[model samples]
Target: MIKTLMGSIREYKRDSFLSPFFVMLEVVMEVLIPLLMAKIIDEGVVKQNMNYIMRMGVILIVLTLCALAFGIISSRFSASASAGFAKNIRKDMFSNIQKFSFSNIDKFSAASLVTRVSTDVVNVQIAYESIIRVAIRCPLLLIFSLVMAMSVNFQLSLIFMAAIPILGIGLFLIISRSQPIFQRVYKVYDRLNNVVRENIRGIRVVKSFVRSEEENRKFQEVSQEIYNDYTKAEKIMAINGPLMQFTVYTCTLLISWFSANLIVSNVMTTGELTSMITYLMQILTSLMILAQIFTMLTIAQASGDRIVEVLGEKSNLNSGTLSIETVPDGSIEFENVSFSYQEDSDKLSLRNINLMIHNGETIGIIGGTGSSKSTLVQLIPRLYDVTSGVLRVGGIDVREYDLSLLRNNVAMVLQKNELFSGTIKENLRWGDENASDSELERVCKLAQAHDFISALPDGYETVIEQGGSNVSGGQKQRLCIARALLKKPKILILDDSTSAVDTKTDAMLRQAFKEEIPDTTKLIIAQRISSVQDADRIIVLDAGGINSFGTHEELLGKSQIYREIVQSQTKGAKVDETE
Candidate 1:
C-alpha cells in the first residue's frame, strides 16, 4: 500500500524533503534558547553587569526570529507537497476507471468510488502534512531537551524516565483499541454516501410514490451508525489528554522538590533549577504532540488502504498485440460463445451462441427479459470479453484488433441513454469531435431529431440539463440516435432505443436508416412485432439460447413464437381501427 501511494508523489519529492530539513533547524534553535537564558540569570544578573545582560538578550532575540522564519517555510512546503500528491492520486484513479471493463466495474459500486476519491483522499492528505511537519520536529525537540536537562543536572533528569514510560504505555493502549473502530467507521461512510446518492437521483420517483418518509428513515439509520462509531472511537482516544496533563504536572512537582533541596545544600544553583523546569515542559509537550500524531495516523491508515485498492486494481480486458486497425466490413460472427460475469456462477448469461451476419444486413432481435439481448451486443465492442469461444468482427477475431479502432467502428446506443450537462452541440460532438455543422444537421435529420432541435429557441446551441432532464423521453432517445449516427460507424446497434418514440416516428427512423446509410449494418432490438417484421432477418432468443433464426416472413409462418406475436398485434390494431 505504501509503495503504491508513494508513486503519485512524482514531482513533489523536493518539497517533501525540504519541509523536514527546515523543521529540524527550527527545533535546534529552540533548544538553544533555554541554555542562553540560564547564563543571563546566573552570570549577568548575579554580578550586576549591564554589558553582559545586553549581549545575551540581543543574541536571544536573533535566535527567536530565525526559528519563526524556519517554521513558516516548513509549513508552506509541507502543505504544497500534500495537496499536489492528492491531486495526482485523483487523476490516476479516474484514468484507471476509464479503462475498466463492465465486469471490472461490477466489482465496485459508484458510491464507493465517489467516497474514496473525495473523503478518503482528504483524510490521507491531512495525515501526510502532519507527518512531514510535526513528525520531524517533535522527536528532535524531545531528544535535544533531554540531553540539555541532564547536562544542567543529572539527578533531576531521571524523573522524566519514569514519566515517559507511563505515558508511552497509555498511548499505545488507546491507539490499539481505537484503530479497529476507525476502520469500521469508513465502511459505514460508504453506506451513508450510497443512500444519499440513490435518494437524490430518484427524487422524482420518490415524490410520486410519496416515500419521502421512508427515504428519511433510511438515511437517518446510516447517519446514526456513523455517529455511534465515531463517538465510541473518540471516547477511547479522550484518555490521552488527562493522562498527558497528569504526567506533566507530576514530573514538574518532583523535579521542583528535588532541585529546591539540592539548592539549599549548595549542590545546585537557582539558575540551573529554572532551566531544568523549562526543559521539563519541552519534553512533556513533545510527548503530547506525538500522541496526537499517532491518533491521526490510525485513522489515515484505513483511508489509505481504501485508496490503494482503487490504484492497485488491474483491468480484466487487455488489447492483444496484433494491431489490426481498420474493419473491412460490418460482418460479425459468434461461434459457440458463452459468457458469465462470475467464473464460479452456476448459469451463464449467454450460452453457446452461434450466428453469422453479412455486411450491410439489417437484423432484428426479440426476446424476453432474461434473454441476454444487451449482453450479446456488448461483446462486439469488447465491453465484456466472451468466456468460452471465438467472436469475430469483419472476419477477424475482435480480441486481435486495437480496442479503440474496434469500438469506433461499432457504435452502440445502449438501453439507457446518457447526456451530460452541456449544450446540445457538445453532447452530439462526443461521436465525432471534429464533425462540421453540416454533418451534425445531417445525422439529426436521419434520426427524426432535426425537426424538434431546430424548433427549440437555440437549435443545436441550446443548453441541456444533466441527464437531459429538460427533454422528453422520446426527444432524449432521438438525440442519442443522432449522436450515434454522427459516428458514421460500420455497424450501429440500437438496444431498444426507439421504445420512447411513437410508431410512426419509429417507422420513419428505420426508413431513414435504409435510405441514408445502405452500406452500414443495422441491428435493432425491440418488443413490438411491427418493429422487426420488415427486417432482412430476425432472431428470437429464449433462456440464454437462440429459439429460431430466419427472415421475417419465414419466421412468421413457421415459428410458433413469431406467429403468436404477429396475430396478437394485428388483432389489437384491427380492434382499435373498428372502434
Candidate 2:
C-alpha cells in the first residue's frame, strides 16, 4: 500500500526530500541553543565575565535566526510536496476511473469514489506532510534532547525514563481505541454524501410528493451518525492532553526536587539544572508531537487503503493490441451471445441471441420491463462485454477495435439522457467538438428540437442548467438526439430516446433519419406499438431471448407477444376515441 501511494509522488520527489533535510538542520540548531544557554549561565554569570557573556549572547542570536530560517524552508517544501502529491493522486484516480469497464465500476458506488478523491485524499495529504516534517523532526529531537540531558547529569535523566513509559502506554491505548471509530466515521461520510446527492438529483420528485421534511430527517440521521462517531473517537483521544500535562509536571517536580539538593550541596550548577529543564521540555514535547502524528496515522491508514483499492483495480475489458481504426460499415452481429452481470450466476440478462443487422437498416426492439432490451443494445458498443459469445460491430469484434474508434462509430443515446450545463451549442458539440453553426442547426432540426430552441430567448446559444434542468423533458430528449446525430455515427442506437416527444414529432424525427442519413443504420428501442410498426424489421424480446424477429405485418401474423402488444395498444386507442 505504501509503494502504491508513493507512486503518485512523481514530480514532487525533490520537495519531499528537501523537507526532511531542512527539518534536520532546524532540530540541530534548536538542540545547540539549549547548550549555548548553559554556557552563558555557567561561564559568564558564575565568573562575572562581561566579554564571555556578550560573545555567547551573539552566538545564541545567530543560532536562533538560523533555526528559524531552516524551519520556514522546511514548512514551504513540505506544503508543496503534500499538496502536489494529493493533486497527482486525484488525477491518477480520475484517469483510472475513466478506464474502468462497467463491471469494474459496479464494484464501487458513485459516492464512495467521490469521497476517495476529495475527503480521503485530503486526509492522506495531511498525513504525508506530517510524515515528512513533524514525524522526522520529533523523533530526532527526542533522542538528541535525551542525550544532552543525560550528558548534563545522568541521575536527572532517570526522571524522563519513568515519564516516557507512562505517556507511551497512555498514547498507545488511546490510539488503539480510536482507530476503529475513525474508520467507521469515513464510511459514514460516504453514506452522508450519497444521501445529499440523491436528494439533490431527485429534488423534483421529493417536492411533488411533499417529502421535504422526510428528506430532511434522513439527512439528519446520516449526519448524526457521523457526529456521534467523531465524538466517540475524540472522547478517547482527549486523554492525550491531560495525560501529557500530568506526566510533564510530575517529571518537572521530580527533576527540580532532585537537582535542588544537588545545587545546595554544590554538586550541580544552577546553569546545568536550567539546561536540563529545557531538555526535559524538548523531550516531552517531542513525545506529544509523536502522539498527534500517530492519531493522524490512524485516520490516514484507513483512507490510504481505500485509495489503494481504486488504484489497484484493473479494468476487466482490454482493448486488444491490434487496433482496427476504420469501421467498414454499420453492420452489427450477435452470435450466440449471452450476458450476466455476474459470471458465475445462473441468471442471465441476455441469452443465446443470434441476430444480424445489415448496414443502413432501421431495426426496432420491443420488450417488457426487465426483458434486457437495453442490455442487448449496450453490448453492441462493448459497454459491457458479452460473457459467453462474440459481439461484432462493423464486421470486427468490438474488443479488437480501439475503444475510442468503436464508440465513435457506434453512438448510443441511452434511456436516461443527460445534458451538461453549457450553451445548447456546447452540449451538442460533445458529439462533434468541431461541428459548425450550420451543422448544429441542421441536426437539431432533424431531431425536431430546432423549433423549441428557437423560441427560447437565446436560441441555439441558450445556456442549459446542469442536467438540462431548465429545459422541458421533451426538449431535453430532442437535444440529446441532436447531440447523438452530431456524431454522424455509422450506427445510431436510440434507446427509448423519443419517449418524451409527441407522436407527430417522433414520426417526423424518424422520417428525418430516413431522408437525411440513408446509409447510417438506426436502432430504435421503444414502448409504443406505433413506434416500431414501420420498422424494416422488429425484434420481440421475452425472458432474455429473442422470441421473434420479423417485419411488423409478419410478426402480427406469427409472434404471439407482438400480436398481443399491438392489440392492447389498439384497444387503448379505441377507448380513447370513444370517450
Candidate 3:
C-alpha cells in the first residue's frame, strides 16, 4: 500500500520535493513565532526593562505578521498545486477508462468508477492539503522546539521528551490500526453511493410501484455499513485528541513545579525559569500537531493508490497506422473471423465468418439474443478487437488505419440514444459542428422528424431536459437519427433503432432513408423482419455462429431458423420475400 501511494505521488513530477519545500517554509515561521513569544515574555517583560521589551515586542509583531502573510500565500499555492494535481490525475483516469477493454469494464460498475473518481480524488486532495498545512508544520516545529526546550534546562525538558516519544509510539499505533479501517470505510462508501445513484435514477419506477419503503430499506442497509466503518475509524482517531492534551498538560505541570524550585534556590533567575516554562508548552503543543499529521498521511496514501490504479490501465484497441486521405466509400470485408472476450476463447461470437459488403449496398443482420450481432457491427468502428479475424474497411485492414479515421466514416445509432442537457440544435451539432440551419433541417426531414419538431413551440431551438427526458421515446429516436444524418457519414448503422416507432412511421423512415441517404452502405440490425426484407443481403446468426447468409428471398426459401422466425413473427400470413 505504501509503495502504491509513493508511486502515485511520483506521477506529477512538478509535485516532486518542490511542493513540500514551499510547505516547509510555513513550518519555519510557525517555530520562529513561538520562540519570539518566549523571548518577549522572559527577556522583555520579566526584567522590568521597558526598552528591551518594546524592541523585542516590535520584532515579534513583525514576525507574527510575516507568518500570517506566509500562511495565506502558502495556502493559496497549495490549493493551486492540488487543484492541478487532482485535475491531471482525473484526466489520466478518464483516458485509462476509455482504454479498458469491454471485458474489463464489466468487472466494475459505473457507480464504483464514479466513487473512485470523485470521493477518492477528494481524499487525495485532503492529503495533499494536509502535507502543506498541518503535517509539515507540526513535525518541524515539534522537532525544533524539542531541541530548544532540552537546551533550556535538561531536567525540565526531560519531563516532556520522555512523554513525547511514548506519545509518538501511541500515535503510530493508532494510525496503523486505523489505516485498514479507512479503506473499508471507502469501500462501503462506494456501495452506499451506488445505492443512492440507482435509487435516484430509478425514482419514477419506485414511486410508480409504491416501493419507496423497499428502496429506503435497501438504502439503509448500505448506508448503515458505511456509517459503522466511519464511526469505527473516527472513534479510533478521536483517541489521539485527548491523549495529546493529557501528555501536554502533564508535561506543563512537571515543568512549572521544577521551575519554582530552581528560582527559589537561586539556581535560575525569574526570567530564565519563565522562558523555560514557555518553551516546554510550545514543544508539547507542536508534537500534538505532529500526531494529527501522522494519522492523515496513512489514509491519503490509500486514496492515492486508487487514483493510480485508474491511471495505469491501457486500452486494448490501439489507434493504428492507417490514415485516410480519402475514404473509399463504405466497403467492408471480414475474412476467417473469430472472436471472444477471453483467451483460448472457444466460445466464438463469429466463427470462420467470411463476408463482404460494397458501397451503396444495404445489409441487414438478424440474430437471436446472445448471437453477437451487436458485437459484429461494433468491430467496424474498432470498439472491440477480434480474437481471430482480418477486418478490412475501405479495402484496408482496419488495424492499418487510424482508429478515429475509421469511426468518423461510420455513424452508429446506439440501442440507447444519449442526449446531453442542451437545446435541440446544440445536440444535433455534435454530428457536424459547422452545419447550418438548412443542413440541420435537411437531416431532420430525412429522419421523419421535421413535422413534430416544427410543431413544438420553439421548434429546433427547444431546450431538452437532461437525457432528453422531456421528449417521447419516438421523438428522441427521431432526434438521434437526425443527429446521425447530420454527420453525412459514408456508412450508417441502425442497431435495433426503430423499436419504439409505429409501423407507419417506421416505413416512412425507411422510405426517407432510401430516398435521401445517397447510396451510402447501410447496416441495419433489427428484430423486425419486415424492416430489413428488401435488403440486398441478410445474415442470420444462431448461437454465436453465422448459420446462413442470403437475400431475404433466398433465406425464406432455405434457412430453417429464418423460416421459423418468419413463421412466428409474420402471423401466418405468407411471409413476404420482398417487402
Candidate 4:
C-alpha cells in the first residue's frame, strides 16, 4: 500500500525532500536558544555586566528569526507537496476506473468509489503533510532537549525518562482502541453519501409519491450513525489530554523540588536550573505533538488502505497481442458463447448463444425483462468478455482487436439516453470530435431530430441540462440517436432507445435507417412489435437462450411465443382505434 501511494508523488519529490531538511534546520535553531539564555543568566546577569547580556541577546534574536524563516519555508514546501500528491492520487484513481470492465466495476459500489476518491484522499493528505514536517520535528526536538537537560544536571533529567513510558503506554492504548472505530466510521460515510445521491437523482419521484418525510428519516438515521461512532471514538481519544497534562505537571513539580534542594546545597547553579526548566517544557511539548501525530496516523491508515485498493485494481479486460485494427465489415458471429456476471457461478446471463449476422443486415431483438438482450450486444464492443467460447466482430475475435479500435466501429445507444451538461453541439461531437456542421445536420436529419433541434431558438447550439432534464423523454432519445449516428459506425445497436417516441416518429426513424445507412448492420431491441415488424429478421429470447430466430412472418406462423405477443398487441391497437 505504501509503495502504491508513494508513486503519485512523482513531480513533487524535491518539495517532499526539502520540507524535512528545512524542518531539521529549524529544530537546530530552537535547541540552541535555551543554551544561550543559560549563558546570559549565569555569565552576564549574575556579574551585572550589561555588555555581555546585550551580546547574547542579539544572538538569540538572530536565531529566533532564522527559525521563523525556516519554518515558513518548510510549511510552503510541505503544502505544495501534499496538495500535488492529492491531485495525482485522484487523477490516477479516476483514470483506472475508466479502464474497468463491467465485471470489475461490479466489485465496487458507486458511493464507495466516490468516498475513496474524495474523503479518503483528504485524510491521507493531512497525514502526509504531518509526516513531512511535524513527524520530523517532534523526535528531533525531544532528543535534543533530553540531551541538554542531562548535560545541565543528570539526576533531574532522569525524571523525564521515567515519565516517557507513562505517556507512551497511554497513547498506545488510545490509538489501538480507536483505530477500528475510525474504519467503521468511514464505511458509514459511504452509506451517507449513497443516500444523498439517490435522493437527488430521484427527487421527482420522491416528491410525487409524497415520500420526502421518509427520505429525511433515512438521512437522519445514517447521519446519526456517523455521529454516534465519532462520539465513541472521541471519548476514547480524550484520555490523551489529561494523561499528558498529568505527566507534564508531575515531572515539573519533581524537577522543581529536586532543583530547589540542589540549589540550597550548592550542587546546581541558578542559571542551570532555569535552563533545565525550559528544556522540560520543550520535552513535554514534543511528546504532545507526537501523540497528535500518532492519532492522525491511526485515522489515515484506514483511509490509505481504501485508496490503495482502487489504485491496485487491474482491469479484467485487456487487448490481445494480435494488433488487429480495422474491422473488415459489420459481420458478427457468436459461437457457443456463454456469459455469467459472476465468473464461477453456475447461473448464466447468456447461454450457448450461437448466431451469424451478415454485413448490412437489420436484426430485431425482443424479449421479456430478464432475457439478456443488452448483455448480448455489450459483448460486441468488448464491454464485458465472454465467460466461454469465441465471439467475433467483423470476422475477428473481439479481444484480438485493440479496445479503442473495436469500440470505435460499434456504436451502442442504451435504454438510458444520457446527455451531459453542455451545448447540444458539444455532446454530439462526442461521437465524432471533428464532425463538421454539415455532417452534424445530416445525421440529425436521418434520426428525425433535425426538425425539433432547428425549431429551438439556439438550434444545435442549445444548452442541455444535466441528464437532459429540460427536454422531454422523446427529445432526449432522438438526440442520443443523432449522436450515435454521427459515429457512422459499421454496427449500430439501439437497446430500446425509441420507446419514448410516438409510433409515427418511431416509424420515421426506422425508415431513415433503411434509406440512409443501408450498409450498417442494425440491431433494434424493443418491446413494441410495431417497431420491429418490418425488419429483415427478428430474435425472440427466453431464459438465457434464443427461443426463435427468423423473419417476422416466419416467427408468427411457427413460434407460439411470437404469435401470443402479436395477437395481444393487435387487440390493444384495435381497442385504441375504436376508442
Candidate 5:
C-alpha cells in the first residue's frame, strides 16, 4: 500500500524532501535557545556585565528569527507538496477507473469509489503534511531536549525516564483501542454516501411515492451510526490529554524539588536549573505533538488502504500482442461463448451462445428481463471478455485488436440515455469530437432528431440540463441515437433505445437506417414485435441460451414463443384502433 501511494508523489519529491530539511534546522535553532539563555544568566548577569548580557541577548533574537523563518518555509513546502500529491492521486484513481471493464466495476460500488477518491484522499493528505513536518520535528526536538537536560544536570534528567514510559504506554493503549473504531466508521461513511446519492438521483420517484419520511428515517439511522462510532472512538482517545498533563506536572514537580535541594547543596547552579526547566517544557511539548501524530496516522492508515486498492487494481481486459487496427467489415461471430460476471462463479449470465452476423445485416433480439441481451452485444466491443470460447469481430478475435480501435468501430446506445450538462452541439460531439455542423445535422436527420432540434429556438446550441432532465424521454432517446449515428461505426447496437419514441417515429428511425447507412450491421433489442418484425432476422433468448433464431415470418410459423408475442401485440393494437 505504501509503495502504491508513494508513486503519486512524482513531481512533489523535491518539496517533500525540503520540508523535513527545514524542519530539522528549526529544531536545532529551538534546542540552542535555552543554552544561550543559560549563558546570559550565568556568565553575563551574574558577573554584572551589561556588554556580555546585551551580546548574548542579540544572538538569542537572531536564533529566534531564524527558527521562525525555517518554520514558515517548511510549512509552505509541506502544503504545496501535500496538495499536489493529492491532486495527482485523484487524477490517477480516476484514470484507472476509466480503464476498468464491466466486470471490474462490479467489484466496487460507485459510492464507495467516490468516497475513496474524495474523503479518503483528504485524510491521507493531512497525514502526509504532518508526516513531512511535525513528524520530523517532534522526534528531533525530543531527543535534543533530552540530551541538553542531561548535560545541564544528569541526576535531575532521570525524572523524564519514568514519565516517558508512562506516556508511551498510555498512548499505545488509546491508539490500539481507537483504530478499529475508525476503520468501521469509514465503512459506514461509504454507506452514508450511497444513501445520499440514491436519494438525490431518485428524488422524483421518492416524491411521487410519498416516501420522503421513509428516506429521512434511513438517513438518520446511518448518520446516528456514524455519530455513535465516532463518540466511542473519541472517548477512548480523550484519555490522551489528561494523561499527558499529569506526566508533565509530575515531572515538573519532581525536577523542581530535586533542583532546589541540589542548589542548596551547591550541586547545581541557578543558570543550569533554569535551563533544565526550559528543556522539560520542550520535552513534554514534543511528546504531545507525537501523540497527535500517532492519532492522525491511525486514521490515515485506513484511508491509505482504500486508496491503494483503487490504484493497484489491474483491468482484466487487455489488448493482446496483435496490433490489428482497422476492422475489415461489420461481420461478427460468437462461437460457444459463455460468460459470468464473477470469474469463479458456477452460474452463467450467458451460456454457449453461437451466432453469425454478416456485414450490413439487421438483427433483432428479444428476451425476458435476465436473458443477457445487453451482455451479448457488450462482448463485441470487448466491454467484458467472454468467460469461455472465441468471439470474433470483423473475422478477427476482439482481444487481438487495440481496445480503442475496436470500440470506435462498434457503437452502443444503451437503454438509459445519458446527456451531460452542455450545449446540445457539445454533447453530440462526443460521438465525433471533430464533427462539422453539417455532419451533425446529417446524423440527426437519420436518427429523426433533426426536426425537433431545429424547431428549438437555439437549435443545436441549446443547453441541456444535467441528465437531460429538461427534455422529454423520447427527445433524449432521439438525441442519443443521433449522437451514436455520428460515430459512423461499422456495427451499431441499440439496446431498447427506441422504447420511448412512438411507433411511427420508431419506424421512421429504422427507415433512415436502411437508406442512410446500408453497410452498417444493426442489432435492435426491443420488447415490441412491431419494432423487429421487418428485420432480416430475429433472435429469441430464454434462460441464458438461444430459444430460436430465424427471420420474422419463419419464427411466427415455427416458434410458439414468437406466435404468442405477436398475437398478444396484435390484439393490443386492434383494441387501440377500436377505442
Candidate 6:
C-alpha cells in the first residue's frame, strides 16, 4: 500500500503539490472553525453579548465557507491526481506489455492482464483519493484537536492521548490479521475474473459444444470461493467499527464523569467542559477514519503486490540498438540452433538446424503440427533466445541488432491475423505510418485485398471491428498481407496466413506477390502443396529438426512426408498442377 501510494505521488507531481496545499488550507478551516465554535459558545453566549456573538458567528461562517470551498477544491485535486496516476500507470503497463515477447504474454493469461490493468488500477486509484480524506484531514484534526484539548485542560488531554494509542494498536492488530485474508481474497478475485472472461470469449464454442451447464457450474464454484474469502476479510475488519465505537463510548462516559467532578471543584468551566466533550468526539472520529484507511491499505497492498508481479518480469527478448542505416541486406542464417522453453529440459524445439536464406527468394517451410516451423521463424527476430547456437539477420547476430531495427526489417503475418478497431487505412498504416492511398492500393493489390476494399461502402475509410471480426477470414488475411507488403521489408514471412482463402484466391495472391515485392525475401509456411509448389526452396520439419530442404521438384522426387501431406491435401492430376 505504501509502495502504491508512493507510485501515485510520483505520477502526479503537479497535482500532488496543489492537492496538499489546498488540503493544508482545508485543515486550517477545520481547526479555525472549531475554535470559533468554542468562542461563540463560551464568550458570546455566556455573556449574552450580541456584538461578540455576531462577530464570532460571522467569522465562523467565513471560516466554514472557506473550509467548504477549500475542501471541495482539494477533493477535485485528489480526483484529478488519482485519475492521472492510474492513467499513467496503465499506459506504462500497456507499453511494457507490448514490449513483452509472446512467451511472456503466455506466462500471464489475457484475463489476468485485464484484471491487473482494470481492477488492480482501480484499487490504487481509490487508495490515492482516500489519502486526501482520511490520510490528510484525520491526522491533522487528531493532532490539532489534542493541542487544543491540552491547552484547555492538561489533565483531560491524557485521556485523548490514551485513546489514540488504543485505536492505533487495534488497527495494527486488525490489519495484521486481515492482510493475509486480503491476499487470498485478491487471488480469488483474479480467478473469478478469469472465469468470466473465459466464459465470454468461449461463449460461441461453449454453445456449439453445448457445455453451458458445465461452464456455469465452474463459474459458480469460483464465485463462491471469491465470496467466502471476501466475507472472511470483511468479517475480520467489520469488528473494527463496533470495537472502536465501544471504546469511544466507554472512554467518553468516563471522561464526562471525571470532568464533571473537576468542573464542580472549580478546576474547569462549563465552556471548557463543553469544548472537551466536542474534542473527545473529534478524537473518536479521527480514530474511525484511521481504521477505514488502515483497512483500505490492506486490500490495496494485496492489489499492489499483484501489479508489481507483472511490472517486475524481465522480458525474455531484448530489443537491440541496430538502426535502418546499418541493415546489410535480406539474408538470414541459423547455425546449430537448439531451443527449449525450460532450461533444464533435454528436449529441444529446433535441433542442430543449419540454414541460410538469401535475398529475393521464396523459401517455403512445411511441418507437422509440432514440427517447430513457427518456432523456427520466431527465432529470426529473437523472440526466444536460442539455447545453443546463433541466429543471424542481415549478416549480424539477431541479438547484436536492436530488436526494433530487426523487427522493422522483417514483416510477418501470423496464422491468426488480429486487427485493431479502426479505419481500414489506419490498420494498413501500422506497417508503414507514412504510407499513402496509392501505396496502400499497391500492397492491397498484391495481397488481393484491393477489390474488397474498393467494394466496401467507405473504401479506405471503412471501420473494422476488434480482431476484424466484421471481415471474412480470407479478407482479414489479405489485409494482413497488405500491411506486411506496405513495409517492403527485408524479409517477409506468412505463417499459413493464406490457409483461410480458397485455392483460386490463393493463386491470385501469389501472382500479386510476383509483381510487387519481387525483390523482398519471402518465407511462406503453408499447409497446402499448391502454395509452395512455385517456391525457390521448400523445407520440411519433423520432430524438431529439418527433415528435408530442396526445391519443390526436388522434394517431390525425394521426400516421403512432403508427398504424404500433398496426397492427403490434394487428389488426382500432377501434384503441382494447382500452383
Give the whole-model CA lDDT for all candidates, comma-separated.
0.92, 0.93, 0.79, 0.93, 0.93, 0.84
Candidate 1 at residue 525, lDDT?
93
lDDT tens readout by residue for model 6, 307-339: 777776668887665454566878888898888
Q: In candidate 2, how many clashes are counted?
A: 0
459-499: candidate 1 lDDT, tens digit per residue: 99999998899999999999999999998899999999999
lDDT winner, 1 or 3: 1
Q: Write the per-residue lDDT of candidate 4 for residues 1-579, one digit (tens) a residue.
A: 899999999999999999999999999999889989989988999988899999999999999999999999999999999999999999999999999988878888899999999999999999999999999889988999999999889999999999998899999999999999999999999999999999999999999999999999999999999999999999998888899999999998999999999999999888888899899999999999899899899899999999999999999999888967588999999999999988754989999999999999999999889999999998999889999999998899998998988888999999988999999999999999999999999999998999999999999999999889989999999989999999889999999999999999999999999999999999999999999999999999988899999999999998898889999999999999999
Candidate 4 clash pair list: none
- Per-residue lDDT value at 279 in model 6: 79
* lDDT assessment of candidate 1: 0.92
Candidate 1: list runs displaced more than 4 Å.
none
lDDT of 2 by residue, 1-579 (tens): 999999999999999999999999999999988888988999999999999999999999999999999999999999999999999999999999999998898998899999999999999999999999999999999988998899999989988877888888898899989999999998898899999999999998999999999999999999999999999999898888888888889889999999999999999998999999999999999998898899999999989989999999998888767856689999999999999998744879988999999999999999899999999999888889888989888788888988888889888999999999889999999999999999999999998999899999999999999998899889999999999999999999999998988899989998999999989999999999888889899999999999999999999899999999999999999999999
Model 5 scores worst on lDDT over the 10 consecutive residues at 340-349
Pick out the ten consecutive residues of candidate 1 with the lowest summed lDDT. Answer: 338-347
Better of 2 and 4 by TM-score: 4
TM-score of each: 0.97, 0.97, 0.90, 0.98, 0.98, 0.93
Off by over 4 Å in 3: 1-46, 95-104, 572-579
Backbone collision count in every prediction?
A: 0, 0, 4, 0, 0, 5
